[model samples]
Target: MATAWFPLWLTLKVALLATLGSGVVGILLALLIARSRLWLRDGLDGVIMLPMVLPPTVLGYYLIVVVGRNGMLGRWLYERFGVSLIFTWQGAVLAASIVSLPLIYKAARAAFEEVDPSLENAARLLGSGEAAVFLRVTLPLALRGIGAGLMLSFARAMGEFGATLMIAGNLPGRTQTLSIAIYDAVQAGDDHRAGLLSLLMSAVCITLLFLSGRLLRARHRA
Candidate 1:
C-alpha cells in the first residue's frame, strides 16, 4: 500500500518544488519581456514559449543534451560540486519546471502588461525607484493574474511525462512521478493502479483549473 502511494507523494513534491522555482523565474522573465526595451525581448519570449508548443519528446531530447552527465552544465556540476542531476528527483523537478514554464510566463506577462503604465510612471514621479514602483504598483495590480498562471504551472508540472521520464528514468521510489507511474502500470497491465493514479491526477488538476479560472475572472473584474 505504501508502495502504491509513493508515486503520488513524489509527484506532489516534484510539482510543488518545480512550481515554486519555475513560477518565480517565469514571473521575473515575464516582467523583463513585458517591460524591457531591449531588442532580445521577442527572442527570449520565443525560446521560453517553445516548450509549450514543441513535442515532449523533442523537449526531452534537448534536456538530455543540455543536462546529461556528459553535457556542459552537468559536467561542470559533477566536477565542481560532485553533484549530478541525472536520474534524480531534482532532475524531474527541472524537467517539470521547463515544461510548465510557459504557462506562468504567459500569464505573468499578460498580467504585467495589463497593469497601466501610467500608474507606474505616477509612482516614479512620486520619487519611487524602479524596484519600488514595480513592488508597489505593478506587482500588486498583477498579482491575481500571476496567481492564475502559477496554479496552471502547478497542474502542468504534476502531469509532466516525457521530459521527466527521460531525465529521471522512471525509478520507482526515487524519481518515478505519478504520470510515469501511471504509464508503467498501464504497460504492465495493472489497471487498478493506473485507475487510482488517474483519479488522483484528475481530481487535483480539475481543482487547479477551477481555481485558476476563478482568479482570471476576478482579475478581469478588477
Candidate 2:
C-alpha cells in the first residue's frame, strides 16, 4: 500500500510555522521577564507556563471559548474579516504554537539568565545601545540554548494532538496531522499505517532530542 505522505507533510508544515512563531515570541517574552522586577516577572512567567501544566483538553477548551465561531475574538474575525480559524489548518498551527511556547520560553530565559552581565555592561560602556548589546553580545552567547529550545518546541508541536484535534478537527489532507493520522489509523484498524507513522514520528522526535543534546553539550564546552 502506498503510504499517505500528506499527514507527514502537514505535520512538518505546522511544526515549522509553530516553532518559528513561538521562538520569536518566546525569546522576546523571556528577555522581558528576565529583566522585569520580581513580582511582575513571577506573575508573567506563571501565566506563560499555564498551558504547559494544564491538561491539553482543558487548554483546547479555552482556545475554543476564545476563538470558536460564536466566541469573542472568533466572532469578530468571522464577521468582519471572514476569517475562521476553527476547523482549519491555521487553528492547528495556533494550537501547536500555544502548547510549544513554554518550552521555548523556559529554555531561552535560562540561557539569557546565564549570560554574563559584565559583558553587557562593558558593551554599554563602549557606547553600544541596548539593541546593539543584545544583538552583538547577549544573543550570540545564548544562541545554543535558543536553538535547543526551538528544536524542543518543534518536537512538541509535531506531536500535538488534543488541542489541534479540538480546534482543527481531523480533516485528512487539510488539518489531519501525523499524530492525528496515527490515531485515526488505529481506530480504523489500519495497524500497519499506524505503526509506520508512529515509527516516523518517533524517529523525528529522537533526532530533534539528539540535536538538542548536542547543542547543550557544545554550549557547555564553550
Candidate 3:
C-alpha cells in the first residue's frame, strides 16, 4: 500500500541528506582535530565522539534543550528568522546527523591522521597553499577511510529512531521515517507491516555496511 510505503521513502530521503550534512561537518572537524597541536585536541575529540556512547534519548534531550522554542539558539532563530526545527523533517535530519556523526568523525580523523605529513610538507615546499595541499595531497590519500566512514554513517542515519522521534513527531506522510514507522506499526499491533518495514530497513542498512567493510578492507590492502 502507498500509505505503508511512505516511511521507507521518507527515511531514505532523510538518511541521504543527513549523511551529506554529517559527512561534511565530520570531515571538517576531523581535519581541524587531526592538524591541531593544542593540548585540548584530545578533549575536543572526546566531545565529538560523545554521541557514539550516549543514549539516543539523552541526545534527543540535549537537542531539545538547545533547539526548543524557548532555548537560546531556538529562540534567537525564531525571533530573527522565524525558523523552527521541532516536529519537522529538517528536525529529523538534525537528529540523524548528530546521532550518526561519530561514525564519520572517527573514521575521518583516523584517515587524516594516517596521511603522510611529509607529503603535505612537500606540497607546501612546492608553493601549494594549505587548501591546495589538502585537496591535492591529503584528501586523496584519506578518501578511502573517509568513504568507509561516510557509508557507515549513512547506515546509522537510516536507523536513527529515538532522537528523531523526539524532535520530529511521527506524522504519517510527513515525518514518519522507517524506524519510527516500525515502532508505530508494532505499537498498533500491525505485525505484518512491522515485519515488512523491518526487513526493508535491514536490507538497506546491511548493504551500506557491506560496502563500508569492503571500502575499509580495500584501504588496508592498498
TM-score of each: 0.92, 0.93, 0.91
Candidate 3 Cα RMSD after full superposition onto the native fold (Å): 2.2
lDDT tens readout by residue for model 1, 1-222:
467688888998999999999898999899888988989888899999999999888898888888788999888888999988889999999999999999999999999999998999999999999989988999999998888888889988998999899888989889999899999999999999889889888887887788778777977787
Model 2 C-alpha lDDT per residue in residues 1-222, reported as the tens digit of each score: 244688888999999999999999999999999877766778889999998999998999999999999899999999999999999999999999999999999999998999999999999999999999999999999888888888889989999999999999999889999999999999999999999999888887888788779877877888
Q: Candidate 1 — which residues are off by over 4 angstroms?
A: 210-222
Largest lDDT belongs to which candidate? 2
Badly placed stretches (over 4 Å) of model 2 are: 1-3, 210-222
In angstroms, give how far residue 66 of model 2 lies from its true place: 0.4
> lDDT-based ranking, best first?
2, 3, 1
lDDT of 1 at 37: 95
Scored by TM-score, the top model is: 2
Candidate 3 clash pair list: none
Clashes of each: 0, 0, 0
